[model samples]
Target: MQAVIMAGGKGSRLAALTKDEIPKPMAPFLGKPLLEWQLEQLKRYGIRRVTLVVGHLKEKIISHFGDGSTLGLELDYVEETAPLGTAGAFPLLLPKIESEHFLLLFGDIRFDIDLARMERFFLEKRAECLLFAHPNAHPYDSDLIVTDGENRVTGFDSKHNVRTGWQDNLVNAGIYILSRDMLRRVPEVKKTDFEKEILAPMAAAGEAIYAYRSPEYVKDVGTVDRIRAAEEEWRSGFPAKRNLEFPQRAVFLDRDGVINRYNGFVRTPEELELLPCAAEGLRQLNSSAYLAIVVSNQPVVARGETSEAELETIFNKMKTLLGREGAFVDDVFYCPHHPDSGFPGEVKELKIDCDCRKPKTGMLRRAAERYHLDLSACYLVGDTTGDIQCGKNAGVRTVLVKTGEAGRDGKYAVTPDLVADDLAAAATKILEEQ
Candidate 1:
C-alpha cells in the first residue's frame, strides 16, 4: 500500500526537542528519528512505499533516509519551497499517488494501530475518507468529530465553540485513509487545510466520509512532555498492546449503581450523575493495560420512557464527565430491549426477549469480537447479581461491588468471583492480581 505523510510542519511547538537543527519529523525519539519509527511501523503493516511531504530543513530528512533501502522501504520526497497547508502538497503529488485509496497522517503522531483492520473497514463502508477517531483524556480542548451510530461523519465541532450540553469524547486522532479521488478538491494546492477545506465540505455535502472509531494507541507526541510520555509508553509496550492485532483485556463495567448513582432509571442527561468512585476507578483502568468498556442494560429505551437519542445524551454526559477527570471509556455496549413489558408506553417491538440483556452474555460477546478480547482473561464489575451472572455466562471473572443493589436485587442467583466496596476497590483488586 502507498502512504503520504505530511512532514512539512516546522514543528514550532517542539522547538525545544528539535533545536531548530532538524525538522519536527526528524526529531529524535528513543535514539531514532520520529519519522523513522513511522516508516518502520508502516513497513510492519506491509506498506513499503511512502512519500514524505517535506519542508523546513528537508535536506536533513532526505539525507537520513535516502531511498529507505536500509529500512526495506521505497521512500520518496516532495519538497515544499514555501509554506503549504495540510492538503496543499497533494496537488503537487497528484502524479505520484497511484492507488485508489492511500493512507495519510501527520508526521508528529506516535501510533501503533491495526492498519489492516482500518483498511478493511474503509473498504467495507466504501468510504471516501476514513478517520481514526477515538475517545481522549481531554476532549474539552480538542477538536471533536461528530459521528452517528453508524460511524458516518455528521459534523465537526471546533474546540473554540462554547459547548454547553453533553458532548461525546470523540476526537480525530490525526490519522486517515483517503481515496485518491478526494485529492481533486486541492486544485492549485495553495495553503489549504484538509479538515476545514476539503473533508468538512465533503461531509456537509453528504459524502462517504466515515469515522472508524477504535481504542488503538494513536497520539500526537509533538511537544517535549508528550514525547517523554510516548517514550515511557513505548518502553512499557502499551501502544503495541492496544493495537487490535493483539488480544485485548478489558474490564466490563455496569453503568447504573456502578459508574453512576442508581436513581431508578436514568431517563435524561441531567438525571445521570457520576458516582464518587467512578472517575478515580476509571482513571486507574485508563492507565492500566485493561481497556475500560461499559456494558449496561438500559430498558428505558424499550419502555418508551426514553428514546435512543436521549439515552445517547445520557452516555455522552457520562463520557463528558469522565473526560473532565482525565478518564474515558474505550467503548460502550448497552441493551435497549426488555421482555414482558406492560408498562405505560412500552414499545411492543422492543419488548421481546433479547440476548443482549444482563445475564445473557451477548454484550460481552460483542465486545470480545470487536476488540479481539480473551473472555477468560477479562473481568466484569457491577453492583447486581444479574451482572455477575452475565460475567459467569461469558466465562469471565466477576467482581460484585457493595453499592446500589449490591446483589440484593435478587433478580438472578449467582456467585461473584470477588467482592469490592466500590468500583475503585474493584479496580485495585483486579490490578493487584494481574
Candidate 2:
C-alpha cells in the first residue's frame, strides 16, 4: 500500500512550538518531527511509499527527510507553489499514486490505527472514499458525518448549522482512504475545500462513500495544549493500545433504564430523556482504558410502537445529550425483536425468540466479534436482572445499578458481580477495581 500526506499547513495556532521556523508538519512532537512520526507509522503498517505534499516551509521538510531512506521507506515530495487548499494538490500527484486505493492523512494529527482492518472494510464496501470516523468528546461543535447502518455516508451535518434535531457523534477524524479514481475526479483542483467541494458532492451524487468507525486514538495536535496532552497519552501507551489490532476491553451498558429515564417504552425521541448520572458515568468510561459501548433492547420496534427511524432518533438524542456533557459512547448495538406475537400493532416477522434479547448473550458476543474484544475482560452495566443474566451468559463481569428498575424486574435469579447506587457510582467502582 501507499500513502499521501498533506503537510502544507502554516499552523499559526502552534507558532509557540514551531517558532515560525518550520511548517506545522515539521513541528517537534515528543522529540521527533510530526511528519516523521506519521511516516514511521505508515512504514510500520507496510505502506513503504509515501508522497508528501508540501507548501509552507517546504525546504525545512526536504532538508530533514530527503528521500526517506533513513526511515527505510521511499519518499517523494510535491511542492505547491501557491495555496491550493486541501484537495487542490491531488491533481499534481496523479502519477505518484499508482495503487487502486491509497491512504490519505492530514499532517497535524497523530493517530495509531489498524490499517489492515480498515483496508478490509474499504475493499468489502468497494468504496470510492473511506473516511476514518469516530465518536468525539464534543459533537456539539464538530462537523459530523451522517452514515447509514451499513456505514454508507448519507450527508454531512456541519457544526455551524443550527442543529435543532438530535445527532449521532460520528465525526470525521481527518484521516481517509481514497481510491485512485478519486484523484481523477478532481478535475483541475483549485483551492478546494475537501469536505465542502469534494466529499460532500460525491456523497450527494450517491457514490459509495463509507465511514469506517472505530474506537481508536486519533487527535489533531494543532494546539500546544493538545500536543502536551498527546505527549502524555503517548508516554502512557494509550494510542497503540487503542488499535483495533489488539483485543479491546469495553463496558457494555444497557440504554433505557441506565442511560435514559425508563418510563415504559420510549416511543419517540421526545420521550427519551437522559438520566442525570448517565453522562457522568459515560465520561468516566471514556477516560478509562475501557471502550464505552451500549447494548440496548428496544422492543418498541418489534411492538410497532416505534419505527427503526424513530428509534435511531431516540439514540441520536441519547448520544447528543451525552456529547453535550463531554461524554460519548464508542458504539451502540440494539435488538429490536420481541418474542410474543399476540400484540395488535406488533410486526409479526420480528416477533420471534431472538438470541439478542435480554438474558441472552447475542449482542455482547456480536460486539466482541466486531471489535476484537475480550469478553472475559469486559463488564456489563445495567439496571435489571436480565442484564446481569446476560452478562453472566457472556462470561463478563456485571454491575447492577440502583437506578430505574434496580434489578427488581424479577425475571432472573442472578446476582451482579457488583452493585452501585447509580451509573456514576458504578463507573467509579469499575475504575477502582481496575
Candidate 3:
C-alpha cells in the first residue's frame, strides 16, 4: 500500500532543541536523522509509494530524500504553501493517491503497530475509513475517537454519549487508511482537519469509519525534552517491533529505592523521604522527550500494612515534591501484590500474579497506552531483577542502579540491560549512546 507521511508544521514547542531552524520531524536522535528512521519503517512495511506532504522546510525535506530511489520506494512530494491542518494536506496530495485504499501517517509520530493487521481489519470490516484507536492516556493531548462494538466510529471525547453502550473511549492514532472516495469529503477550495471536520460527522451518520485497536508503542517527538527521551530509549536497548523508527524513551523508576528511601512499606507521607537527585533526574526525564514514569510493586497496601488512601497520600506527597522542584512525573503506576507473602489485605490483593506489577509490563503498558509510547523505545531504571524483567516484558531497556536497594546481588538480583552507579550516572548514560 502507499503511505502518506505528513512532514509539515513548524515545531515551535521544540525550539529549545531545534533552535529556530527545523520542524519536530527533522529533529536529530541516535546519531541518525529522525525522519530517516521513519522512512525505514515504511520500507519494512512493504509500502511501495511514499508521499511526504511538505511545508515549512520543504527544501530541506526535498534535499534529504532526493526522489526516494535508494530507499526502494517511489517518492512523491506535495508542498503546501501555507500551514494546512492535517486533513488539509490531503487535497494537496490527492493527485498522488492512486488506489482504493492507502495509508496516512503523521510524521511527528513514531510508533510500532501491526500495520498488516490494521489493513486486514479495514478489508475485513469493509470500511471506507479505518482509524487506528489506542486506549487513551491523555484525552486532551489529541482528538479522541470513540467507536461502537461493531467497530464503527462513534463520538469524540467531547459530548460522547456514554449511554449508547458504545466503547466511546480510544484516541485517534493519527494514522489512517481511507478509500480514495473519502477524499471527496475534502472541500475543493478550503482546508480541513479530518478529526475536527470530517471523520466525526461521517461517523455520526454511520459512515464506514472505524477503528482497529492495538496496544502500540509510540511517541510524539514534538518537544525538545521528548526528543531527549527518545534518544534515551534508543540507547537503553529495550526490545520492540523492528518496523518502527521513531525514538521512544522513558524513565521507569523504583518506588522505594529511587523515589524514596527504602523504608519498610512506605505507606504514609511521613514515612516517605524525597531523594535529592531523584527529582533532578525526573525533571530531566520529563523535560526531555521521554515519558517519565514510576513502576513499582507496593505490596504493603495489599498486605493490610497500608491502605490505598495511604498509597495515594504517599504519591501525592511525591507529586507535590517533584512539582516544587520543577520536575514532573508524567505518570506513576504500582502493583500491590506479593507473590507468596499472603500477609492479609496486602497479602490477598498482592498475592495473585498479574502482568502490571514490577517484573511484568502491566504498569508500563498502562503508560504506553496513555502516551502512545513505543515500548522498545522506553527504558526502566530499578534496583532488582523484577525491574529488568519488567523492562524486558514491555520490550523496553532496563538499567540497574547500585546506590540504593538494588545494590547487593542475591536471588532477586537481575542483570539489567545497562547498569549505573546512581541516578545521575543513569541520566548521564541516558544522554550517551550505547
Candidate 4:
C-alpha cells in the first residue's frame, strides 16, 4: 500500500562516478537521476504514495522530487536528524508508513520488482516479513544467505558466514516488506543492521520470515565494476532481449519454444532439453533488466499425459540448470487447460478453454497488473505465429525465431518486428539499438 525508499545513504563507494556531487541515490545513469528511475518503477507498480528516508545529500533528493507532483505521487521525507543504519530508517519512518504492511527498497539498486504480487503473497501466506533474494553473483557479492529452507533467514554474510557448498548460492535482495508492528519492536540502539540484528534474530526465534526469490535479474549498482557491468549489460541487451532507450516495457516469452524447449509439450525434465545458447540468450535479457517471464500452454497436463507434480519436477530441474548457467526465469505462467480433448480423468481439470493460455495475453495482463509492467512497451518472443499473434493481441512487440518451422511457411504474413535465427542473435540486435 505504501513504499519507503532508503535513499539517504552516502554511497561512499561510488564517489568517482558521482563527482562528489550527490548521494548515490541522486547519481546519474543515462542522464537520469538514479532515484528518478526508482520513483518511476514505484509509479509503474501503483505505489503513488512514498516516503524517502533522506540523510546524506538529503537536499538534492528533496529538491529533485519536490513534493513528487510531477510523478503524480504523494512524496514525504524522513529527514533523519542523524544518520541511521538501514534497519534504523524503518523505525524512524514508522510513523509515516500508515499501511499495516509496507515495502522497503534500497535506492542504490536498479530492479524490476512485482510489489503487487508481493503484497498479496504476504497477506495470503500471513507472513510477518518477506524479503527478495537471488543467487549470489560471484566470489564477492554482498548479501545475506538464506537457510531454514528460505522460510527462516538463518545467516548473514558480511562477507561473513560465507562457506562453500551453499546449494542455492542465494543472497538477500536488499528489498523487504514488514508488518507495521514489526517496526515498533525494532531496537533504537546506535548503528544496527536489518540483517545481523533483525532478520537473523527473527528467523532464529521461529518467526514467519519468508524469502521471495526474483528468479530473474536483480542487480545492486553499489560498486564501480558493478555499475559498468550494468551499463554494458544495458547496452548489449544481455539476454537476447530488446532494448528501449526510454520505452516502458514488460517482456513476454513463450515457454516451450522460446524459453525452454518446443518438443511438442514439455511434460518432464527428461523430455525437456534447452535449445542451443538458451541460457546465454536469457542471460543477456536478464542483464538488460527486462521483466523476463515464461508463458506457456501445457495441454499435455490437461490430457493426463503429465501430472502437475510432474510439471513442478520439470520446473525444479529447469530452475537449477538455468541458475547454474547464469540465466534464470523471473516468473513462470502456464495454462493446464485443454478445450478439445483429454485422457480420462485428465479432462476434468483440463477441459475448459482458459484465458491464461497463449494467444491471449491474460497471463501477460495478470503479470502486468502484478508487476506494474507497462505492456505497451512489452515484447513477446516465440517460435510460432501464435506467439506473434499473442503479442499482437496484447498490443506489444512480436518477434519470431526462424529456428522453428513456423517461419518456414509464408502463411505467417503478420510480419514479426525482428526475426532472428536464435534468441542470442536477436538479443544482440536489441542491444545494438539501445
Candidate 5:
C-alpha cells in the first residue's frame, strides 16, 4: 500500500537540534534520522511506496532518501513552495496515489504499529477515514478523541475546549488511513488542518470516521523531552518484543461486579444493567493506552441458567449501553466451566475443570497472545479475590475496587496493588501511575 509522510515541519520546538538547517524529521534519534526510523517501520509492514511532503530545507530530505532504492522503497516527493497545512499536501499528490486507500502519518513521530490489522479494521467498518488514537501523559492540553463502542469517531475536542470537564483522554496519534474520496472533502485552499478543518467538521456532519485504538508505541518527538522518551522506548525494545507483534498494555476488568451491577448471576439481557460510572470509567480506558478487556467467570452456562447465546446477548446489551456513553471494551472473555456436578438442569459436558476459569489465568494468557500484551506492564482492575489472583497469575499488576460483591471493607485471599472506591477511581489511579 502507498503511504504519505508529512515531513515539512521546521522543528521550531527543537531549535537547538535543528540549528544547522535540518528538518524536524531529519533530526537525529539514536544516530539515525527520525524519518529513517519511520520509513524502516513502514517498509517492515510491507508498505514500499512513499510520498514525502517537504517544505523548509526540503533539499536535505530529498538528498538523503532520493529515489529510496537504498531503503527498498519507491520514494516520491511533494515540495511545497509555500506553507500548506496538513491536509493541503493531499491535493498535490492526488494523482500519485492510485490505491483506494492510503496511509497518512506525521514525519516527526516514532511508532511501532500493525498497519495490516488497522487496515482490516478500516475496511471492515467501511469508513472514509480511520484515525489512530492513543492516550498520552499530557491529555489536559491535548486534542481528545471521542469514539463509540463500535470505534466510530463521534466527536473531536481540541485542547482549547476547556469547558468540557473530564472528557475521554484519547488523543489523535498523528496516524491515519483515508479513502481517496475523503480527500475530496479537503478544501482547495492553500492551507487546511486535517483535524480541525477537515475531520472535525465531517464527523460533526454525520460522516463515517472511525478510531483505531491501540497500545502500540506511537510517540511524537517534536519537543526535547518527547525525543528522549522516544529514544528510551526504542532502546528498551519493549515496543517490538510484546504480543501482537508489538508491546501492549491492558486493563483487565471483571464483568459482573465491576462492569455492571452484581445481581446474582445475570441470566438475561434485561437483567444486565451497567453500574453507576461504569461507562465513564470505560470511556477513560477507551481513550488511554490500556486495552480495556473484560475477563469474567460466567458459570451460569454450566449450570444451564444461561445459554451461551443468551450470554452473548447480555454482553451485546452491555456494549450498546456503553456505546451510548462513548465507552468501549477492546475484547471480552468469559469462563463458562464449572467443576461442581449434580445440580439440576446443569450441562453435564460443561461440568468439568477448565483452564479458562478465573484465578487460573487462562483467559488472561489467551488474551495476551491474541493482543500481544505485555503482562508485567499491564493492570487488572476488578472487585474480587479471584480477579486479583487471575491478574497476579498472569504476572500483571492488580487493583481491587470496592464495588459489587466486594464492599469497602471486604477482604480478599490475596492483596491487590491498590484499592479504590470504584472502577472510575481505579481508572484514575491507573492513569496517574502510568
Candidate 6:
C-alpha cells in the first residue's frame, strides 16, 4: 500500500528542538531523525512506496533519504512551494497516487500500530474515510470524536470547542486512510485544514466517515515533555512489545444490574429495560479508548428458564436500544453454568462448576487474550461482590455501583476500589482518573 507523510510543517511548538535549520520530522530522536524511525516502521509493515510532502527545510529531508533506496522504499516527493494546510498537499498528489486508497499520516507523531488490521477494517466497512482515534492523557484539551454504535464518525470537536458537561474521550490520533474519491471534498483553496474543512464537514453531511478506535501506541511529540515521554515509552519496550500485540484497555461490566433494571432474571426481550442513563453511560465509553465488555452470570440457562438462542435475542434487543442512543458494547461474555441440580427442566450437563462463572476470572482472561488487553490497566464495574472479586482475581481495578445492591449488607471476599451511585457516575470516576 502507498502512504503519504505530511512533513512540511514548521512545528513552532517544538521550536527549541528544531532550531538547527531542521524540520520537526528531521529532529534527532534516539540517535536518528524522527522521520527515519517512522520510515523504518512503515517498511517493516510491508509498505515499500511512500510520498513525502516537503516544504520547510525540504533539502535536509531530500538529502537524508533521497529516492528512499537506503530504506528499501520507492520514494516520491511533493514540494509545496507555498504553505498548504494538512489536506492541501493531498490534492497535489491526486494524479500521483495510483491506489484507490492511501494512508495519510502527520510527521510529528510517534506510534506503533498494526496497519494491516487497520487496512482490513477500512476495506470491510467500505468507508470513504477512516481515522485512527485513541484516548490521550488529556482529553479535556484534545480534539474529540463523536461516533455511533457502528464506529461512524458523526461529529468532530476541535480542542478549541467549548466543553459540554460530559464528552467522549476519544481523540483523533492524526492518522487516516482516505479513499481517492474523498479528494473531491478538498477545497480548491491553497490552504485548508483536513479536519476543519474536509472530514468534519463530510461527516456533518452524513458521509461514510468511520473511526478505528484502538488502544495502540500513537502519540504526538509536539512538545518537550511529550517527546521525553515518547522516548521513555520506547525505551521501556512497552509500546513495541505489548501494545503492538494487544494494547486495548477495557471496562468489564455486569449485565443484568449494571446495564438494565434488575427486578429478576430477564427471560425475554420484552422484559428487558435499560437502567437510567445506562445508554448514555455506555455512549461515553463507546467513544473512548476503553472497550465496553459485558461479563454476566446467567444461571437461568442451566435451569432451562432461558435458552441460549432466546438470550441472544434479548441481547440483540438491548443493543438495538443502545444504538438508538448512539451507544454500544464491544463484546458480551456470559456464563450459563449453575452449580445446583434437581430443577424440573434443568440441563443436566450444565448444572456443574464452570470456569467462566462469576468470581472465577475465566471470562476476563478470555477477553484479555482475545483483545490483547492488559488486565492491570482495565476496570471492572458491577453492582455485586462477585463482580468485584472477579475483577480482583483478574488483576483489574474494580468499582462497585449502588444501582443494584447499593453496596449495603454486602458480604464478599473483596472490596471495590471505588463506589458510585450508578453506571454514569462510575464512568465519570474512570475518566477522571484517566
lDDT (CA) per prediction: 0.92, 0.92, 0.71, 0.72, 0.83, 0.83
Better of 4 and 5 by TM-score: 5
Candidate 5, residues 1-434, lDDT tens digits: the string is 79999999988998788885899999999999999999998998899899999999999999999999999999999989888888887778887798899999998898888888888889998989999886554556677787665678878887787533234456799999999877677647488888888888878887889988766678789987889887887787766643256667889999888989987889988788899989889878866667888898999999999998787678867765676567777777889999999999999999999999878989999888768788999999887887887788889999888888773333446889999888988999999997
- Per-residue CA lDDT of model 3 for 44-160, tens digit only, reads 778888888888878888887889998777898988888878888666667888888998888777666667767878999899999877543333334556655466877666534
Clashes of each: 0, 0, 24, 7, 2, 0
Q: What's the C-alpha lDDT at position 384 in model 6?
A: 87
Using alpha carbons, what is the TM-score of model 2? Answer: 0.98
RMSD of each: 1.1, 0.9, 9.7, 7.2, 8.2, 9.0
Q: lDDT of model 4 at residue 130?
A: 86
- What is the RMSD of candidate 1? 1.1
TM-score of each: 0.98, 0.98, 0.55, 0.61, 0.69, 0.67
Best by TM-score, which number?
2
The sequence of per-residue lDDT tens digits that candidate 2 reaches over residues 1-434 is: 79999999999999999999999998889999999899988987899999999999899999999999999999999999898898998889899998999999999999999889999999999998999999999999999999888889989999899998889899999999999988887789588888898899888888999999999899999989999999999999989999999999999999878999889888988898999999999999999899998999989999999999888888999999999999999999999999988999998988999999978889999889889999999999999999999999999999999888998899999989999988899999999998
Residues 47-104, candidate 1: write the lDDT tens digits.
9889999999999999999998999999999999898888888887788889999999
Question: Model 5, 9: alpha-carbon shift in Å?
Answer: 0.7
- Model 3 — TM-score against the truth? 0.55
Point out the higher-scoring one by lDDT: 4 or 6.
6
Candidate 5 global TM-score? 0.69
Q: Rate residue 359 of model 1 by lDDT.
A: 88
Error of 3 at 259 (Å): 24
lDDT of 4 by residue, 1-434 (tens): 78889887888899988866888888776678778988897798788889998987888889989999998999999887677787776667777888898888888987655567667778876888888776542424445455553245655556554545323345687888888877876757355677777877887787888877544345788877777777776666542232222333556777676656665777667877777767777788776646677787778888888887677667656655666677666666778877876357575856887897778778888777655578877788888877887888888887788665545545445778888777777676666656
**How accurate locally is residue 417 in candidate 6, as Cα lDDT from 0 to 100?**
96
